[model samples]
Target chain A: AQSVTQPDIHITVSEGASLELRCNYSYGATPYLFWYVQSPGQGLQLLLKYFSGDTLVQGIKGFEAEFKRSQSSFNLRKPSVHWSDAAEYFCASKGNTDKLIFGTGTRLQVFP
Target chain B: EPEVTQTPSHQVTQMGQEVILRCVPISNHLYFYWYRQILGQKVEFLVSFYNNEISEKSEIFDDQFSVERPDGSNFTLKIRSTKLEDSAMYFCASSANSGSYNEQFFGPGTRLTVL
Candidate 1:
């Protein structure tokens, strides 16, 4: 079975500061990776996805992630975060069966 | 923009009662999925549907749970008998196809509270 791990349970960042969320996956073959952000009382919004080709993929809200095959990691990064960026972020991996295995989310608190 | 939608933002029901959660995927989407997230836990896949049939299902999807696309637009998940453990946020997602090009579009989840 494919699984995903998010090491950080909670992270706090001041507005305008940089942010990095770590994600790792365990899968036999190359997996499709994704990042999603969910706000209070809102649906999970896709941040980005990595299927093939480029190792670095860009997403909305100035977010980006680097797919490091050797590390089995797909960490989301943003140089500057806004106050609205505060939300729960989830890392997911899609198996050959096409099911997305999500990790425990990381709750990001952005302080102004 | 086109997006998936779920109805009844919240539902409260007694244990042992049956409940059905409804969702409308984006028009033209071919692959549909149901997932649930227990409080403070990861979102787990329950089942996937395509071609008017189930394409895949996780172990969590047992006899107690069933999914049906009763119409061209509506996809529903039914719980035969609810348990306290069943109280969680249920999400519906749809993809244009099984191809990698089309990612899944998630709907605002329906929060089910079993009393």
Candidate 2:
């Protein structure tokens, strides 16, 4: 079965600091990876995705993700995090199916 | 900008009652999907619809659950008998295509609370 994993359950970072949320996936073939963020009481919003060719993909709200085939990882990164960036981040993948398999999610807390 | 929209932002229901969640996918999109997330669990896919029929469904979507696109703009998911375990945030998503690379835009979601 294909699965996506986010090792960190919760992470705290100071405002204006750099942020990196880790993600790993298991699939038989090259998977289409994605990162989504959900604020409290809000729906999941797509941050970025990785399909082919480009290992580093840019997304809305100054977010970026790098897809590493060797490690089966697609990690999300953002420079100079703002207080509004505090949200739950989820990593997802699609493999052989249209259904997206999502990670458990990592709650990010931005401190001033 | 076009985006998926779901009705009844929040719903409260009793066990064994029937509940229907409605959604209006993007006008030009051809694929629709339903997913749910428990309070502290990962989001799980429920089912996908294309060409007015169910293309795929997950194990969690049992006999009690059914999906229908009754009209050109409305897609609905109905639970024959709601269960307490069904309490979760249900999201509706639509994509222009069915390929793996196509991005699926999600709706605000309907939070269902079954008591």
Candidate 3:
């Protein structure tokens, strides 16, 4: 079985500051990782995905994540945060079954 | 950009009643799936449909839950008896039926509230 863990349940950051959201997964083989953002009462919006090849994958909304196989981590990072970035972030990973297992999620509150 | 589409953006049903959620996947896509996110929780997979049949489903997708592609373009999720716990955002997603790499396009989601 595969599972995902997002260490931070909630995070608050000031606008223009760098941000990092941690994500770790437990899977037997190489994991297919993804980051999704959900606004209040809305459906998920795909942020990015890392399947194979390049470890560092860039995504929309000025976000990116690096896949560290040995550490079993795919942490999301941004150089600077914007107030609009405040939302719930979820990290999901899939393998051979192609079934996505999502983490608990990290609530980001960006303040100006 | 081509994207998945879902109907009845919101549905309110009484407990123990049957509720069906509908979706229209991208025209070129071949694989479809249904996922739900309970309030303040992660999105959980319910089932995956492909080739006019079910390819996979999670434990949460028990006997009470079923999916069907009734026609050429519609995919639907039917819950035999709606429970209060079933009130959540139901999302329909689709991909090109190739592999796990191509990102899945998601619909706006149907917010089901069972009272």
Q: Which digits, one per residue and each the tens of the lDDT, describe model 2 over residues A13-107? A: 99999999999999999999999999998988999888899899999899999999999999999998999999999999998778999999999
Q: Write the per-residue lDDT of candidate 3 for residues A1-112, one digit (tens) a residue.
A: 7999999999999999999999999999988999999887666789999988999999999999999988999999999999999999999988887678899999999989
What is the alpha-carbon lDDT of model 3 when measured against the actual structure?
A: 0.91
Best by DockQ, which number? 2
In the range B3-110, model 1's lDDT, one tens digit per residue, is 999988998999999999999999988999999999888899999999889999989999999999998889999999999999999999999878566589999999
For model 3, fnat equals 0.66
Q: For each candidate, what TM-score against the reference?
A: 0.98, 0.98, 0.96
- The better-scoring model by lDDT among 1 and 3 is 1
Q: Considering only chain B, report the TM-score of model 3.
A: 0.96
Off by over 4 Å in 1: none
- Given the true complex, what DockQ would model 3 score? 0.67
The better-scoring model by TM-score among 2 and 3 is 2
How far off is residue B1 in model 1, in Å?
A: 0.3
DockQ of every predicted complex: 0.75, 0.84, 0.67
Tens digit per residue, CA lDDT, model 2, B1-115: 8889999999999999999999999999999999999999999999999998899999999999999999999999999999999999999999999886778899999999999
Ranking by DockQ: 2, 1, 3
For all predictions, the C-alpha RMSD in Å is 0.9, 0.7, 1.2
Which parts of model 3 have CA positions greater than 4 angstroms off? none
